[model samples]
Target: MINLYPVLKPFLMAVEPEAAHRAALGLLKSGLAPRYRHDDAALRCEVFGHVFANPLGLAAGFDKDAEVIAPMLRMGFGFVEAGTVTPLAQEGNPAPRLFRDVKNKSIINRLGFPGRGLEYFVAQVSDFRVAQGAGAAADGMLGINIGINKETASAFEDYSRCLSALAPMADYIVVNVSSPNTPGLRDLQSENMLDALLAGLMAVLNSLDIPPVARPVLLLKVAPDLTSDQRAAVAQLALRHHIGGLVVSNTTVARPEMLAPHLREEAGGLSGALLKDHACAVLGDFYRLTDGRLPLIGVGGISSAEDAWQRIRAGASLVQVYTGLIYEGPALVPDILRGLTARVRAAGMAHISEAVGADIDLAAPRAEAAA
Candidate 1:
């Protein structure tokens, strides 16, 4: 094994950004094909009501159709989440919709929510995971990230329909109220809107109520653009209605300090190192406000193990990455898991949860209170 990544970077990054991503995913799928991913790294941890080999995972949008999910899991993620799949398949915004910021190690994507419809993705994904068995990569937790159509008024219904269909085959379900590309989707984060959306969706989930064995988790993903007040409101609301928990802070619409380039004019969400602070702030607010009452899954500009640690301490029980995987490639997985273990040891904690919120509000007594 030759890591041709160094040789491939300049040429790949030199091309159109979205093309580069397609190329990279093609390579990852072929190089670490589904059948060969079992032994890359044994990085497991327990989260989302199941056991994960490690806290590292590929975020939604990476495997839009769920075609390569098994390979992503095999590639060494403690787990993997796929899709923002709608009731109908859409082509997404338009090509040239994804861009790379070489200097910041970031990616700007307005790809919209392109993917095959819920039924198609669910059929394939269900059969795929069930094929994994009692002890296999498929045995590791599998989360289905669901969203509504870009042009649908039935937003709430769409989420339920998808969840009801996919939940049977899923280990967890994420209610994606945050992707910046979708119009009014982020609005669902408002307390009133979120309450109804979750209430309706939960009604559907409740109808499917299978007792004894664990039901697929229902997670709410929020935007990074939310104000401090909104962050607290989200946690409070989740607790109020008992939404499965929260996936704090999705790709941000805000741009941090940047390179002097025309790409700055590109519309869409920016993710990667630039997103770290806003995400941490949101997570910290949620931690302090919720007192870690609601389980949190962190997603924002995560590019390294240290970043994972930051989110964990800020109150995330687990973390997900998308942009970092684009810039750094699949090798980034094991690197993050190894780094997480090292950081966990440095903090003198036996389990990762002990480190959750370890640094956030540390001076406030409660942050250090968890540790």
Candidate 2:
């Protein structure tokens, strides 16, 4: 399709970042977002018992309240993850929470979880599903990401309640314990807390009224900031609880030295090109830690197909992007998939999955020089 992001970037950049975000969503919901259909065989892949048209997805935070999911899917993402929704609606931090670092092609956001909450989110998805019919659901998957309210009395209980309330509408339920904007939220990633959280969520899944055939897949979204021991602990806990998958990372609290001086100091999660290496390393670590048995959806940098392919080779079964969309526009999806198809062909593989982790060692870290 025509690339409009470049022509629109100057205008988009002039607006406040958060307002620009909402404006873009407005365009999407208004039936004005770019749309393209890609039926290339090489891009098709499957995981978590579902067939994905491609392995690339629109990560959480971009469509936080389930708005524009169908429009986003039509833009060619294999799936779209919506929300970091809490039990009740929250305004999140204050204004000037989302900042863009144009030079570094990154974003630092302390927007917290400014969303309409579970009741509205679930209703929107339920209504959208019915309006679109089977064609929409068959077109792409919708992954619902849930988190706790900033002031909730019990984080674990909020997660269970949200999952229980939204399971029927969710293709998958993501337990978000790693967003740094929520105070003490990242602390939920601690071994004991995460173990208890996942166990409780699994129990919620078992207790859901939905039939087994309609049960949503369970996945964990984690932060890139973790020590080796912590990563191993989280991986083990995930396997122990039979979690369906893991979104290899959220965004990092660590600021890269190279980020522009003005943008580096923002007190929120850092994402985009600045995040590429660290996110891949974390994905590789989890891949090796789990021996590639656990499916991972890598997110963080991923601005191009090379980035996506590298993460897959490092061990991500699927990948997601958000900041890349801001920088590269709607054309990014088809571009990456096209390049990925070429890479798969060059590697002499019939399918993209065949190349996953092919260049990495399970016992050691792959050096930067190796790639």
Candidate 3:
């Protein structure tokens, strides 16, 4: 597909980031966005019991309300995770919350969980599944990422409500306790808090009327800012709770020294090229902590297939992108897929899964020392 982003980037850059996002969503929903499809035996893989067309996904913030899953899937993402959807509709932070660092190819967003609420989100997803008839699985997997409202009295109440409503429609459900924009949300990542939260959420998952085999896989989206102790604690808690996977990670609040000084001061999570190294380091931490027992979806800088490949070797079963899209456009999806296919062949692997964690040795003395 011809990339129009180069032509459109100037115009999009002139508009407010959030407004441009909304317009892009509107265009996608109207079927005006370019569509690209990629299917390669070498790039296919299964994670959390579902087979994906590829290992590349569009990360959560891009389609915050499940508005364009089909369109995004058509654009060649192996999967599309929608929302950081709250239990109630929220206006999010305020204007000027999303800022661009063009030179660094990064973004800073304090747009805390702004969405149309669970009811509207569920309806859109349900309609998408219905429209796909019996062939929904062929279109690509759908992951619904749910989060609590800003003023939620109980995170469990808000989370369980979203889980109950969206699980039936989701191939996997991401409990997002890591968005820095939401006050007190990151606190949920604390060991005690996360343990209790996971216990409560697992109870809710078990109680659901859905059959165990058909139940949506439960995953957690975490931040990249955890202390070493916090990371170890999280890994232990996740393993103990039998959570299906972890998205490592959400955006980071820690500003990189390389970021433009003005953009670095933005009060929000940072993502994109500036975040690449730290996110990968955090991802490697989780992989070692979990000992590759849990599937990890790596996000936070992946604009190229090389980035995705590095993530896989570092133990990401799948990789995702959002801020990268702002710079590269939809053509990035196919480009990454083609590159991955080549990498798999170069590595003499028949399938992408063979390369997952190829660089990690759980038995290494260093890993044991760290443990």
Better of 1 and 3 by lDDT: 3
**In model 2, where do residues sit more than 4 Å from their true spots?**
134-138, 363-371
Candidate 2 residue-wise lDDT, 246-313, digit = tens: 89889899988999898767799999999999999888888877788988999989999999999899
Stretches of candidate 1 exceeding 4 Å from the true structure: 31-44, 134-138, 362-371
Q: Per-residue alpha-carbon lDDT of model 1 for 49-118, expressed as tens digits?
A: 6877677778888887887776677766767888878989988897879877777877788999988888
Best model number under lDDT: 3
Error of 2 at 18 (Å): 0.9
lDDT of 2: 0.88
User: Which 10 successive residues of model 1 have the least lDDT summed?
Assistant: 34-43
The most accurate candidate by TM-score is 3
Give the alpha carbon lDDT tens digit for every residue of 262-299 in model 3: 88667999999999988887888788889999999999
What TM-score do all the candidates reach, one by one? 0.91, 0.96, 0.97
* Candidate 3: regions farther than 4 A off: 134-138, 366-371
